[model samples]
Target: MTIGVIGGSGIYEALPLENVSTKSVSTPYGEPSEDVTLGELGGKEVAFLPRHGEDHQHTPTGAGYRANIYALKSVGVDRVISTNAVGSLREELPPRTLVVPDQIYDRTKHRTPTFFGEGMVVHMSFAQPYCPEMVGHLAESAREATDADVSEDGTYVCIEGPQYSTKAESEFYREQGWDIVGMTTIPEAKLAREAELSYATVAGVTDYDVWKDDSEVSLEEVLENAEANQESINAVIEHAIRTMPEDFESEAWSALEGTINTPTDAIPSETRERVDLLAGSYLD
Candidate 1:
């Protein structure tokens, strides 16, 4: 029942992975964002990968998404809790807030969003994209773990970035009721589903974007809030892992069984070989 946690922005390094071990994984899709740190947390086995690499070298769009998800799957990680630093769109969820987003609206472009490509294709349901049960457990953890106001559920809008959105785009997101905005999470969530892993995001709100009338959202302010919020995020994670039930096998891993829709015969040999570690249950 090992769980994987992909630490996103301002989380370039995870608290020293206890009982540390290092694993270099090769995925059918290619290499992951970085080497994975395998260790013990809450007396349970766990794996952690820094999404932006150890030095935060990769941008959101530059993240090796397919490989990152595949590496987790390769290590027997059945569920993932991705953490990201996002800009708060709502006033109540201002800087230093924590949100466990239950839904996502994708606005990203130029990235592979699924594993079924080449000779195989599968259309999976994303109606309830993030895993509900997992999300509930996380929300509870955040509430009990920190003093930071934790929004139980929120809509996370994922946009292509290297550049923040224009004021018009930000306002449009507000109109659609988006709570936070970020550059990652879409294909990460999508690929997690394709891998049949229960996935959810614990987003750390670091700023009120430029849309805030009186406040100027600057990188300095974002960094300041992000630094302030890290301790709380760490608390939530530690507490969540400590209280995580021992039956992750039955609940979280079950999704991996029938979720793959690609027909066996139709799957290309190369793709199968490349993803053997991940899709072995269905392909083998």
Candidate 2:
């Protein structure tokens, strides 16, 4: 039961893993953000990938969403815990608050949000994007591990960006009742479902965004809050991994059971080979 952790801003390093070894994994999609770091934490095998590369070179749109998810899946990761630095749309959810979002709204315009396309197609049920069980575990872990406010559930509105949101855009998201605004999570969450891996995120609020009259989102401010929140995020992740039950079962494991649309024989050989890791069993 190897758990995969995708680190967001200010979280390039993972929790102290034992007997750590780094592995560079190439996928059919392309290269992963960085080498997958493998180690043991709380007696569980863990694989960690930095979402934006170790040096934060990749932008949200440029990060290899398909490759990263594929790489983790290839390395025997059955569950993924993603950490994100996000801006709060609500006043009450202030900086340093940790949110376990159960819902996601894709405001992203430029990203491939699926692993199945071209010669193969899968209509996976995404009514509930995040794995409820995983979300519960993360939320409980945060409450037990941190004194910072933990939000059990909320909507994460994912936008396309290297740029922060405009004042109008920020206000619109707030009007939509979204809790947090972030750049990543759209395609990552969508692709995880396609790969049959349980996935959820611990979003650490870094700023109030541009919605607040007196608040102006800045890199310095976001980084400061993210650094401060890293301690709590690390604690929650370590505790969750340590206490996770080995026999845990997720509906995501069978997500491809009846979702593959193309008949096995009809799929192009090249396309079939490309998706073999994700949909091969279903195609058979």
Q: Top model by lDDT, which number?
A: 2
Per-residue C-alpha lDDT of model 1 across residues 123-145, encoded as one tens digit per residue: 66787778888889899999998
What lDDT tens digits, residue by residue, belong to model 2 across residues 1-284? 99999985344354777898999998989999999889998889998898889888999999998999999999999999999999999989999999999999999988988887788877889988999999999999999999999998999999998899999999999998999999999899999999999999999999999999999999999999999999999889988999988879899999889888778888988888899998887776
TM-score per prediction, in order, is 0.93, 0.97
Q: What RMSD does each model have against the real structure?
A: 2.1, 1.2
lDDT at 75, model 2: 92
The candidate scoring highest on TM-score is: 2
Off by over 4 Å in 1: 8-16, 249-262
User: On a 0 to 100 scale, what is the lDDT of residue 174 in model 1?
Assistant: 94
Candidate 1 lDDT for residue 101: 90
Model 2 spans with C-alpha error above 4 angstroms? 8-14
